[model samples]
Target: MESSKSASDEGTETASKVEVKQDEFSYLEREFTSELFKLEINNLGIFGIGDFKKMLKSLEIDAAKVKTPHKRDCAFICLKSKEALDEAIKKLTGYVWKGKTLSVKIARPNADPYIKRKNEEQQEDSNKKVKRTVESQTVPLAHLTYDQQLEEKDKEMRKVLTAFGNNLRKLNPSFKLRKDEIPCEFEKIKPSPKIDDYRNKSEFAIGRNSNNEIVVGFRVGSYSDGSVEVGEIAKLPHIPSKVKEAVLKFQDFVRQSKFLPFNPEFNSGHFRQLMVRYSEFSKEIMLVPGMYSNNLTEDDVTELKQSLKDFYSDGEGNLVDVDSLYYQHLGKRETGEMFNPVDHLCGKTHITDVIHGLSFRVSPLAFFQVNTAGAEVLYQSIIDLSEPKENTTVLDICCGTGTIGLCFAKYCKNVVGVEIIPDAIEDAKFNAEQNKINNCKFHVGNSDDYIQSMVKEVVYGTLKKEDLDLVAILDPPRSGLHKKSISAVRSALDLKKIIYVACNPKAAERNWLDLCKPESKTYKGDPFRPKKAIAVDMFPHTSHTELVMLLER
Candidate 1:
């Protein structure tokens, strides 16, 4: 007998046919990269990434990497040069496979799709007789009043939630979602208390501005939009003046420093990115400057760090009023967790903040909501939705910094939080002690990997109670929990309730479907019924918002 392969082994192996994605070229001014080309094999829907790689190898093409934008019909071959791309297309075109005459053609790549968009925007602007600047490109809604922005965001969220409910209905049609049987309605979206300058975190890219000078700020557009030019975010409505000041101060320092800003195309230079975390509660700011040493020596790295320290402490960098300074070494991976160990150079190691009268230490890896004031509102909404009583035990899943669990612990009998990141669990544990909260018990591991056992522990083991009830408070990242975690929650009839706090509710609809779907052999326990739903406008002047929903048996 052989063991079955886990989901991680195959890398995004799914049963769905043709995972369609929005055209990346729709955005104006994206990163410029022509080194790689895509080959859209019309009949390759049956093939996986492994098959694509093997097929390329069989063709005797020396490509560096093969990736798909989750499209089964397309394969992106990352080659060294134009000659290599031409060679790959030349070899693979019109190749026969699996009783089909394969017609492989050049396809749209995510890297460079902006030339047309830029031209169109330019043409549109010329026709309208209006000139658009980088500020417009970065934050288009910045010109709108705060109230107007909130109204626009609410409209966007209404559209998003409608699509979200449709996904739920499509997945499990047997169970009526948002119909009479399933009670669900979108409450009024709460506005951020502090509309302007509400962003607590900003990751500024170190790149050249229009003047081609080394600058520290946000990109004019997203990378997928083929944008590489970093622009000043000083006028961005969401960015705090203090954070903007820090960006300008760093820009000046980088301009004068001997080191150069990191180039994504060339992959050279030392200074890469600057991450700022400002805590409204603590009135403290943590600065983490990112750099790569691919072109530097140990002595060079030490010299750069020392210069940064001196600049912030006594030089012009002091204008931003730096409270904490840290350094992060860069890694090669382009996306997903792109950071090495963060070294604390000086001042506070963490940005301490209080929510719901409880203090939490936000570490470099720990996740926190960008809007501090809105987080309080969101937490309160979740509490109000769940209505945790004295005999309740809250199982906080993916509890970062233990804010959500700790927030509930004060009302519930006890809260048991499980998080994969050790740093996050440590912060949760420390927060529990700091706030004199002893009911919280957090474990560090992949939530799905260990959640079943913990769920069993709470349901059939020590935490089980006759009078007490178990409710799961899921606040997973945008990429929701593994299906097994959803099944784990659904497997236990004793776990009666789920209060899901989603930054991206659209992504969480799948989990919601699994929880509410009729129980089968695969899904072993009784399903939960969808109840009240509330939306929080954590991000103002932006389309993003937070959602809190209650699900019970």
Candidate 2:
């Protein structure tokens, strides 16, 4: 009986090892070709306890519903010996043993080795077409003349100085105003509020403005003499005791009410001391009868009507959809995309065809160009410079909602988009589906990880060759690409072109150095280098600028 028990125990151990190997094989197979694996399992697999456990482990089947690049639900599978893995899958799943080549499906839709390899062979031909065109083109910089540049610089300095003088005059009434109204210098501005009482040792105080609005702030140190001073003002300081009690009661009512937008004035100690909450005061001023009597358009008027409906609704309150109006107006006007919430109200749509034949809806949290018209020009420039074709396969990195990729898709064979934000990925997918665009695919996750793992996996794990050609369009954040991301792109053997878009030039320069470095792995064997550069005036009145560089191998 003891000998029989030992044999049974040995049999159990053998079963456990088989189960473990099957589980690992299932995982790798699913990771590489999930859809194909599922098809095989469902049509061929025999029911067993081990098979059920394998199904339980592959929860990623559901997670792939929203395929954000960084958060892709697929795993890395080494496909060096496809036959071994295929045989194992067939045995475990009881499927027909046919030696069909495995392929990537959902993880990278429409990504095929044949097409990518074909693109590699034809890259030289494409480069020949663009070489003369790009090399012969010279960007005009005549607008930045030396005298005009100096004049512009002087004007900016004067404007800043004038604003400083006005602030200083408000702080100190007896600072001796300039005769010619010359602007105040940085050194001339006071550090704190001025006060007549020299004995007061407190650091700060509040004051009322000419409009009887509370403006309580005081400075401790002076700019000229390094002296300390205080300024204070009271709005309705001499209210009757009965009126004060009534005001306090009214404040309590305002707090309990849910009809006000959050205003800093009400919560500030200086404003609260007067028993006049900011919301109550704003409503008393802004919510007056016939306040929006401007010559608003029909759409504006409709928006106002909707606003009134929301304001008066007793249930299901929603924050006024500020961004929707902005985009709608911009789209109608054919102008650039606008992002500022305040712009939604007064911003007039400029009639132009800048964004003609193109439309995109941005996610609330996504970072996009705030000035709509400027963005149109920027995107137009990208479209013009990219020179996308039916044969080109575009890869848009940091693709928010895949706008650029989708725009290029109608002209390109395929557009693969990558974004880190899940919501942005959703927007991209929705946009693609809405347009009935099958050539464009979006995934969520860090671009660096996707490039390092997914790109290589698709290339070597499946393609087994690094001779393919790829174009990487990088629109990294102001902080630019992480170090790992730089290394991945640098090491990629198939990349033929890289379009670097930077909101911050300084950060761009840093990444550029990393890419251009002779010793860096990214630049080792290839002769690819930054061939062209362009600057876009994203913000007209600000120091911020957008720079784009084209790199080619």
Worst 10 residues of 2 by lDDT: 277-286
Tens digit per residue, CA lDDT, model 1, 110-132? 53344445434544645665443
lDDT of 2: 0.43
- RMSD (CA, Å), candidate 2 to true, equals 27.5
Q: Give each model's clash number.
A: 5, 16
Give lDDT per model, in order: 0.74, 0.43
Q: Candidate 1, after superposition: displacement of residue 6 in Å?
A: 46
- Return the TM-score for each candidate structure: 0.78, 0.41
Best by TM-score: 1
Q: Which residue pairs of candidate 1 clash?
A: 30-225, 30-226, 30-227, 31-226, 31-227
Residue runs of model 2 more than 4 Å from their true location after superposition: 1-356, 457-468, 521-528
Model 1 alpha-carbon miss at residue 220, Å: 1.3
Deviation of model 1 at 30, angstroms: 19
Error of 2 at 311 (Å): 4.7
